[model samples]
Structures are given as structure tokens and as C-alpha cells.
Target chain A: MKLIGYFRSGASYRVRIALNVKGIKVEHAFRHLRKGEQKSDDYLKINPQGLVPSLLLDDGTVLTQSIAIMEWLDETHPQPPLLPKDPVNRAKVRAFALAVSCDIHPVQNLGPLNKLAAFGIDQANVTRWAKEVNFDGLQACEALIAAEKGPFCFGDTPTMADICLVPQLVNARRFGADISGFKRILEAEAACLKLPAFADAVPEKQPDAE
Target chain B: MKLIGYFRSGASYRVRIALNVKGIKVEHAFRHLRKGEQKSDDYLKINPQGLVPSLLLDDGTVLTQSIAIMEWLDETHPQPPLLPKDPVNRAKVRAFALAVSCDIHPVQNLGPLNKLAAFGIDQANVTRWAKEVNFDGLQACEALIAAEKGPFCFGDTPTMADICLVPQLVNARRFGADISGFKRILEAEAACLKLPAFADAVPEKQPDAE
Candidate 1:
């Protein structure tokens, strides 16, 4: 498999963590997102959505969407499972993941942020917008997992929830979202980063990092 | 089971379609999204995210996030499966679903649009923002499924992809995103709506549509 990604992309960071957890080795490729290489024709053929973290399989099948790729990876490589075995627990884990993937990430993504700038929302407000988005979404995420006893989002081990949460917290901090109030989330992030899998997947550690 | 949802919420509508597809009947409740009823203290207790389409199970287990709920539903009641049996095919179906759920719908959701307005983007530009989000997202969705010989998004049966697609099209048209050029998407929409599961779940048909 050849994993196509950008260093700073939360979605790409997600797949990298999953790959590391499963101890799977795959070829790596980079798309310079800041330069808009992901929107190029060649990249579009691999992922029509022009997003990074597309997994190109040895059989030549390309998989897009980080959550879907992670699901497929979990299914195909079940060791150190990223999700719990029970139906309800799986839903909880997935819900937590989506809290980051669907709710938090997309609004502050490069595409929408750039669109805001194009509409002449000044850089300050655009930055404010990203900060607010991160803060608000992370607040909800913090509350969602408040009941769980966790060094991780769900339990002692890292699941998909923590996989998603770690990267998003990285993003939240980048936008200066002031996530200091999110104790549970910060605790989970600390637990995750202690492991080589999560530590190694940080944006700065990736081969594509500028 | 009880489903707490607003009729016009795309996330809620996706679950409604999934429920109808699975032939599961549940008690229905509404949170008037426009009135901010979903953010009520009582509602937030059920869902910390305070989002719609939360499925409350019989034992008082509340499941949030429509995609996760749908996956749980598929797992617990797997007669007419929402995902294909094959891992690769399942990935394909899920990627298509995420294209709408993660990429398209959230950007144009009430929260972000209202935030844009608060940032002093005029109402007309807010509408334009929604329109472009729909148009760009649907265009990519169209391309994502271009290779399929689909009456549905995959082969014959309606998978999670079709469930996600139909609601997003409703949202896209609501925003006046001109989808006339998206041939494959339109075809898939036509195929999906022909089924009562999809048609009956339309916002206008729901009890709280007003």
C-alpha cells in the first residue's frame, strides 16, 4: 500500500496513527497541500474529492476518506484493534471519532478557511473563525467523553476515538483554540502521545513536514 | 428505541432512511433546530454534542452521530446489510457516505452558517457560501461514484452511500445548488427516492416538518 498524505492534515494524521497501531508498513507519498497539489489532475484520479490520506492498495485499488480507510485497515488488520469488539462500544468509539472528523475538522479545514478569506473576511477574523470552531467543537467533544474513565478517550488503550482526538487537539492548539479547559481530552492526548504510534505520527515527524 | 431528530436535519434524515430501510420502528421525538431546542439542557443530557439523530436504545443507551448509529443499527440488525460483505467494497461504500456526511453537510450546517453571519458575512453571501459548498461537494460526489454501474451508488442494493447521498441532495437543492450537471448523482438520487425508505424519509413527510 502507498499512503498519500500531507504532514499537517488531521485526516492524514489519522491514517498514519492507525497504520502505526497496526504495525503495518506501507509506502508513503506526499501531496504538498499548501501548494494545492492535491487538487491536481493526477491526485484527483486517486481521490476525486482531492483530499489527502488516500491509500493506494497493492491491488491498485485506491481508498479515500480517512475514516473509511481506518475502518478498512481495522477490518483487514485486526491486531491491536482500533475499535472495541462490542456493538455499543464500537458506536461510542466511532461517535467520538466523528466528533472530531465530522464536527471539528471540516469547518476549520484549508478549503473552507481559504473560502472565508476569498469572501474578504480579513485574516484576523478568519483566524478567529478557525479558533472558535476548534474551541466550540472540542468543548462538545470534551463533554461527550466526560463520563468515561479514561487515560484514553474510552479506556486504558487507544481506540479510534483517541486516534482522532490526538490529531484534532494538535489542530486545536495550532489555531490557538485555548483547549486548556478540556481536561479529559488533554489527558487522553497525553496518554496517546506517550506511545510511539501516536508520538511518531505527529505532523512534525512525518516525511512531508516543512 | 426512540430517535430524537429534526425533520429537516440532514443527519437526522440519514438515520430515518436507514431505519426505514431496516424496517425498524422507533418512537419519534423532535428538537426544533431553528429554535435551538437541540441545545437545551435536557437534550444535551441525552447528547453532549447536542446534535440531532441520536438513537436512544431501550436500556437507556443513547447513541449519537448518525453514521455511528447507522453502523450500530446495521450491526445489531443485519438482514439487509447497509455495507457490503467485502472489506474493499465496504470501504468504497463508506467513502461515498463520508463524502456527503463529513465533507458536504457539515460545512453548510446551521452552526457554521450562523457563525459566518456573526462574522459579518451578509445573508446573501451566507447563502452563496452554502450554495458553493453544496455545488463543490456534490460535484466531487458525482465524480467519486462515476465508475460504478449504479442504479445505486454501488451495484444494485442501497448501501450506506445511497442513504447518505439522498439526504445531501435534498440539502443541496434546498441551498439552490444547481445539480443539473451531476448526471451520476442525479441518477443515483432518482433511484434512491423511488424506494419508500428514501421517499418516506423526506423532510416534508416527517411529522415535525413545520
Candidate 2:
């Protein structure tokens, strides 16, 4: 398998963390997101949306959407499952992941941020917008983990929720958001960072690390 | 099962069509979004995120996120599968779905519109933003379907791709987008409209239909 991605992309970060967890290393291709490389013809051929973290299969099929790719990973490689076995628990896990990916991340993406910049919005305003929405997502997710006692977001097993949460939290911290209210998640993040898979896969460690 | 949603919510509309396709008659608990009812403590107890299309199970397990709910519906009711059997095809179908739900719909959501309003953006600017993004999504989706030779988004069947497509098309129209570039999707919407299941689930036809 091959993964095409930008190093600092939260969506790509999710994929890297998942791949590391699965112990599957791929031929990594870096697209320089800051240089407008995602919109290049070659990259657009890989993902028509010109988005990062498009997984190219050995047989040459490409997968987009970090959650969808993560689900495919869970389905095909089950030894260390990203989702829980129980359906209800699985729903909770999936809901948490989707809440991050769907409700939070998209609105604050680089594309939209660039659009904001196009309107003569200052860098501070752009950062503030991203931080504001992402902080809201983190808070909502923190509330979700409230019910389920966790070393991770769902339980201690490091399901898909953990894969999603770590990157989002990383994003929040990077943007200077106040993450003080989410105590349990802070604990979970510390635990997640201790693992070699996660630690080594941090965006700064990637070949294309910006 | 009970679904908490407004009739005109495109996200909720997707789940409603999925449930109808599976012949699952869950109770519909209306949350008048226009009236700010989703912000209530009762709804937040079920879904702290305060997003609509929250599905409450008989055992009291509530699921949020339209994609998660749709997948749960597919898993629980397997007769007419929303996803295809092949991994490649399934990835293709799901990418098509996320192109709207993840990338497009969230940006044009009511909250973001309200945010733009607060940013001193005029109604014309909000409408312009919504139409542009929604239409960009439609054209991308149209390319996906056109490549796959679709009566629906994938084939003749109304997969999750179509479930996402039709609702966003409705939003696009509501925002006065010029969807003329998406000839194939308009065709798909017409096809989706013909299904007794899809027809009955249309937002305007629902109990709280605006």
C-alpha cells in the first residue's frame, strides 16, 4: 500500500497514526500542502478533491476520507481492531470519530482557511476561527467521553476514537486552544503519546514534516 | 427507535431515507431547529453535541452523526445493502458520500451561516458562500457518478452516496445554486424521488416539513 499525504494535515495525521497502530508501513508520498501541491494535476488524479491522505492500493485503487479509510483498515485487518465488538459500544466509538471528522475538522480545514485568507482576513483571525471551532469539537467530544470511563476515549483498547482524538487534540494544541476542561482526554493523550507507534508518527517526524 | 431531527435538516433527511429504505419505522421526535430547540437540555442529554439526526434505540442507546446512523442501519438491516460487496467499489461509493457530508454540507450548515452573519457578512454573502460550496460538491459528485455510469450514484440502486447527494441537492436548490453543471446528479435526484421510500422521506413531505 501507498499513502499520499501532507505531514501536518490532521486528516493525514489520523491515517499515519492508524497505519502505525496496525504495524503496516506503506511507501509514503508527501504532497506539500503549503505550496498548493494538492491542486497539482498529478495529485488531483489521485484525489479529484485535491485533498491529502489518499491511500493508493497495490492493485491501484485509491481511498479518500480518513474515516472511510480507517473503517476499511478495521475491516481488512482485524487483529488490532479500531472499533469495539459490541454494536452499541461500536456506535459510540464511531459517533465520537465522526463527530471529530465530520462536524469539526472540515469547517476548519486548510481549504476553508485559505478561502478566509482570500477575503483579506488576517492570519490571527484565521487561526482564531480554526481554534474556535476545533475547541468546540474537543469540548463536545470531552462531554462524550464523560459517560464512558476511559484510559482512551471509548475504553482502554485504543479504538477508532483514540485514532481520531489524538490528532484533533494535537491540532487544538497547535492552534493555541485552551484544552484545560478536557481532563480525561488530556490523560488519554499522554497515554497515547507514550506508544512508539503514535510518538514516531507525529507530524513533525514525517519526511514532509513542515 | 426514535430519531431527533428537524424535517428540513439535510443530514436528518439522509437518515430518514435510509431508515425508510430498510422499512424501519422509528418514531420521529421533532427538534424545531428554526426555533432553537436543538439547544435544549433534553436533546443535549441524548446528544451533547446538539446536532440533529440523533437515533435513540429501544434499549436507550442513542447514536449521532448521519453517516454513523446510516452504517448502523446497514449493519442491522442487511437485506438491501447500502454499500457494495467489493472493497474498491465500497471505497468509491463512500468517498462519493463523504465528498458531500464531510466536505460540503458542514460548511453550509446553519451554524456556519450564523457565524458568517456574525462576521458582519451580509445575507447575499452567506447565500453566495453556500451556493458556491454546494455546487462545487455537486459537480465533483457528478464527475464520480458520470465515471461510474450511474442511474443512481453507484448504479441503479440508491446507495449511501445517493442518500447524501439528494439531500445536499435539496440544500443547493434552497440556497439558489445553479446546479446546471450537475446534469447527472439532477437525474439521480429524479430517480431518488421516484422511490416510494425516498419520496415519502423528502423533507418538505415530513411532519415538520417547512
Candidate 3:
């Protein structure tokens, strides 16, 4: 398998953590998103969406969308399962991930942020836009996990929820979002970061980190 | 199962189609999104994210996120599956679905459009913001399925990809997006709409549509 990604992409970071957790060794490649490499003809042929973290399977199948890829990994490599077996619990974990993936991340992504700038919004306001979206969404995530006894998002071991949460929190802090009030989320992040799978996938630790 | 939703919500519309496709007899309830009912304390307790549609299981478990709910239905029901059985095909379908779910729909959602308004973007400009995002993302979606032989997005059968596509196209048309160039997508949508499962879930056919 081979993974094409950018160092700072949270979606790519989530997949890196999953690959490490599943202990799947794959070749790595990079697309410098800031430099417009991902939108080049070669990269677009690999992922029509022009997004990072497209995984090329040995059979020559390419997978895009980080959550979909994570679930595929869990199904194919079941050890250290990224999701619980029960259907309802699995939905809960997925909902938490989507709370970030669907509701939060898309609004704050570089594409939309750049679009906001094109609309005549200044850089300072663009940063504020991203942080506000992060703050609201992360607050909801915090509430979702507030009552759980967690070394992770769900329980002692990391699941897909934790995998997604860790990267989102990294983005949240990077944008200077005030997340101090999200105690449960902070606790889960602290716990997940202790694992090498999560630690080693940090943006600065990636092979293409600038 | 009971589903709490607003009739025009693309997210809710996706789940409604999935339930219809899976032949699950879930009771329906409505939250008037324009009226701010989804943000009510009662609804918030059910889904802290305060989003529709939230599915209430027979066991009293609440499931949020349209994709998550659709997957749970597929897991529990099994027959007339919403996804392909093969992992690669499944990822392809899911990636297509997430192209709309994660990228397009969220950015054009009522919440974000309202946020753009709060930023002093006039109503016309806000509408332009939504139309532009929808046009670009749906164009990418068009590219993803352009080569497939589709009565649906995959093969003849409707998978999660078509489920997601139909609602998104509805929103695209509603926003005056020029979808004429997306021949494959339009063909897929027309084919899916001919089925009772997709037809019955149309927003105008729902009880709460106003």
C-alpha cells in the first residue's frame, strides 16, 4: 500500500494514526498542499476530489475520504479495533467523529478559508472564523463524552472517535481556539497522545513536515 | 425506531431515503429548523450536537449523524444493503458520499450561510456563497461518477452514494446551480427518483414540509 498526503492535513493525520494502530506498513508519498501540488494533473488523476490522504492498495485500488479509509482499515485489519463491535456503540463513535468531520472541519478547511478571503474578509477575520467554528463544535464533542469514564473517547483503549478527536484538537489549538473549557475532550486528547500511534502521527513528525 | 428531523434538511433527507431503501419502519417526527427547534434543550439532550436527524432505537439509544445512522441501519437490517459488500467498492461509495456529506453540504448548510450573514455578508452574497460551493463540489461529484454505468452511482442498485447524491442534487437545484453539464449525475438522480424508496423520501412529500 502507498499513502499520498500532506503533513499538516488533519484528515491525513487521522489515517496515519490508524495505520500505526493497525501496524500496517505502507510506502509514503507527499503532496505539498500549500504549493498547489494536490491540484496538479498527476494528483487529480489519483484523487479526483483533489484532497490529501488517498491510499493506494496493492491491488491498485485507490481509497479517498479519511473516515471511509479508517473504517476500511478497521474491517481489513481487525486487531486493535478502531471501533467497538456493538452497532449502537459504533454509531456513537461515528457520530463523534462526524461532529468534527462533517460539522466543524469542512467549514474551517483551507479551501473554504481561502474562499472567505476571496469574499473580501481579511486574514484576521478568517482566523477568527475558523476558531469560532472549532470552539462551537468541540464544545458539543465535549458534551458527548462528558459522562464516559475515558482514557480515550469511549473507554480505555483508543477507537476511531479518539483517532478523529486527536487530530481535530491539534487543529483547534493551532488556530488558537480557546478549548480550556472542554475538559473531557482535553482529557481524551491527553490520554490518546500518550500512545505512540497517535504521538508519531503528529504533523511535525510526518516525513513531509515543513 | 423513530427519526427526529426537519423535512428539508439534506442530512435528514439522506436518512429518510436510507430507511426507505432498507425497508425499516421508523416512526417520524419533525423539528422545524428555521424555527430554531433543533437547538431546544429537549432536542439538545437527545443529540448534543443539536442536529437533525437523530434516530431513536427501540432500546432507547439515540443515534446522530446521517451517515452513521445509515450504516447502523445497514448493519442491523442487512438485506437490501446500502453499501457494496467488497471493501474497495464500499470505500468508493463512501468516498463519493463523503464528498457531499463532508465537503459540500456542510458548507452550504443553513447554519453556515447564517454565519456568513452574521459576518455582514448580505443575503444575495450569502446565496452566492452557497451556490458557488455547491457548484464546485457537485462538479467534483460529477467527475467521480462520470465514467460509471449508472442507473445508480455504482451499478444498477442504489447504494449509499446514490442516497447522498439525490438529496444533494435536490439542494443544488434549489439553489439554482447549473447542473446541466453533470449528465451522469442527472441520469443517476432520475433513475433513483423512479424508485419508490427515493421518491417517497422527497422533502415535499414529508409531513413537516412547509
Candidate 4:
């Protein structure tokens, strides 16, 4: 499998963590978003959205959307299952993941930030927007895991929800947001950092890490 | 089962369609988004994200996130499956769905548009941003379905991809977008409209329809 990705993209980072957790071997193809390589014709053919983290399956199928890609990887390579076995529990895991991946990350993404710049919003306000939205998004996630007595969001094992939480909190910290208030989320991410697979998947550790 | 939703919220609309397609009966609880009801203590207790479309399961499992709710419904009651049978095919279908659900819709939702206003972006530029992003997103969808030769996005029957498409087109039309350029998508939505379940499930026909 060939994974086309960018280092700082939270979506790509989630996929990276999932691949590592599943112990799947994939060739990394970095498309630097800062360099505008994703807009190039060759890459557009791979993903029309011009987004990073397009996973090319061994059978030549391409999977886009980091949430969908993560789920696909979980289904195909099930050990250390990214989802809990029960369907209801599985949905809860996905809901937490989507709460971060869908509700938070997309709005603060590079394209939307650029759109803010286009709207003539000041740098202070843009950073404010990022921090505010990211915190609000994470707060909901923190509230979610408080349901189960969680060291990890679901339990002792790190599932797909943790994969999403760590990267989003990384984004949250970059803006100087106070994530220590989000107790469960902070604890879950802290648990993940102790694992080698999770540590190795961090953006700074990647070969093309910016 | 009961669904806490607001008419015209794309997320809420997605659950409406899924319930209809699955032939599941849901007691409707409408929260007026324009009235700020989603922020109420009652609603927030159900969905901490203050988002629309929380599905209260028969067993009292309150599921958030339209995709998660849809998938859970599919698993618990599988007659008319929203996903394809094979794993790879299901993954491909979900990848297409997420391309729209996660990639396109969330960033352009009513919440984000309000964020634009809070940033002092004029309504015109906000509309412009929505148009540009939606068009780029539609092109991505069009490019993918072009290979599948769709009357619907995937084939003859509607899938999760089509569920996502219809609401997005609703947003496009609400914004006065010139979507004739996206003939395939428009055609796919039309085919969806022909189904009783989809037609009855449209926002205009809902119990709380405006």
C-alpha cells in the first residue's frame, strides 16, 4: 500500500497512527501541502479533493477521508482492533473520532484558515478562532468520555478515538489553548504517548516531518 | 426511538433520510436552530457538541454524529443496507460519503457561517467562500462518480454517498449556487427525489418543515 500524506495534517496523522497500530506496512508518499503539490495534476488524479492522506490499497483501490481510511484499515487489519467489538460501543468510538475529525479539524484546516485570511481577518482573530473552536470541539470530547470510567476513552486499550484525540490536542496546544481542562481527553492522549507505535507516528518523527 | 433534530440542518437531514430508508419509526423532537434551542440545557445533555440529530435508541443508547447513527442503524436493522456487502466495496462507498460529509459539509455548516460573521466577514464573502468550497467539493464527487457511471452516485440504488449529496445540494440551492455544472450530482439527487422515502424525508416535508 502507498499512503500519500502531509506531516502536519491532523487527518493524515490519524491515518498514520492507525496504520502503525495495525502493524500494516505501507510506502509513504509525502505531498507537501505548503509546497502546493496536492494541486498538481498528477496528485489530483489520485484524489480530486486535492487533500492529503490518500491511501492506495494493494488491489489498487484508493481511500480518501481520514476517518473513512482509518475505519477501512481497522476492518482489513483487525488486531488491536481500532473499534470495540460491540456495535453500540463501536459507534461511540466513531462518534468521538468524528467529533474531532469532522467537527473540529476541518474548520481549522489550512484551506479554511486561508479563507479567513482572504476575509481580511487579523492574525490575532484567526488564532483566536482556531483556539476557540479547537477547545470547544475538545471540550465536547472530554465530556463524552466522562461517561465510561476511562483511562482511555473506552477503557484500558487505545481505540480509534484515541487516534483522533492526540493529534487534535497537538493542534490545540500549537495555538496556546488550555487543554488541561479537558481531563479525560488529556488522560487518554497521555496514555497513547507511552506507546511506541503512537510515538513513532508523530509528525516530527516522520521521514518527511516538517 | 426519538430523534432530536432541527429541520434543514444537514446533519439532522442525514439522519432523517437514514431512518426513512431503514423503515425505522422515530418520534421527532425538533429543536429550532435559529432560535438557539440547540444550546439549551436539555439538548446539550443529549449532545454535548450542541449539534443537531441525536438519535435516542430503543435501548436508550443516545448516538451522536449522523454517520455513526446511520451505521448503527444499518447494523441493528439490516434490511436495506446503506453500505455495500463486501468490505472493500463498503470502504469505497464510505470513502465517497466521507469526502462529502467530513470534507465538504461541516466546514460550510450554519455554525461555521456564523463564525464568519463573528470574524466580521460580510455575508457576501461568506456566501462566496461557501460557493467556492462547495464547487470544488462537487467536482471531486463528480470526478469519482464519473467512473461509476451513476444515475445514483454509486449505481442504481442510493447509498450513504447519495444521502450526503442530497442535503449538500439543498445547501447549494439555499445559497443560490449555479449547480447546473454538476449535472451528474443534480441527476443523482433527482433520482433520490423519485423515491418515496427520500421525498418524504426532505426538510420541506418534515413535521417541523418551514
Off-target runs (Cα >4 Å) in candidate 2 are none
TM-score of each: 0.99, 0.97, 0.99, 0.98
Total clashes in model 1, counting residue pairs 3 or more apart in sequence or in different chains: 0
lDDT of each: 0.93, 0.86, 0.91, 0.86
| Interface RMSD score of candidate 2 | 1.3
Q: Individual DockQ of the candidates?
A: 0.92, 0.69, 0.86, 0.80
Best prediction by lDDT = 1
lDDT of 4 by residue, A66-172 (tens): 88887777777778799888989989998998898888998888888877888899889898999988988888898888877678889999998999988988899
Better of 3 and 4 by TM-score: 3
- As for candidate 1, its clashing pairs are none
What DockQ does candidate 4 have relative to the true complex?
0.80
lDDT of 1 by residue, B18-55 (tens): 99999999999999999999999999898988889899
> How many angstroms is residue A168 displaced in model 4 relative to the true structure, after the best TM-score fit?
0.7
Q: How well does each candidate reproduce the native contacts, as fnat?
A: 0.92, 0.53, 0.77, 0.78
lDDT of 1 by residue, A1-33 (tens): 999999999999999999999999889999999
Ranking of all candidate structures by their TM-score, best first: 1, 3, 4, 2
Compare candidates 3 and 4 on lDDT and give the better one: 3
When 2 and 4 are scored with lDDT, the better candidate is 4
DockQ, structure candidate 1 = 0.92
Residue B97 of model 1, lDDT score: 95
Residue-pair clashes per candidate, as listed? 0, 0, 0, 0
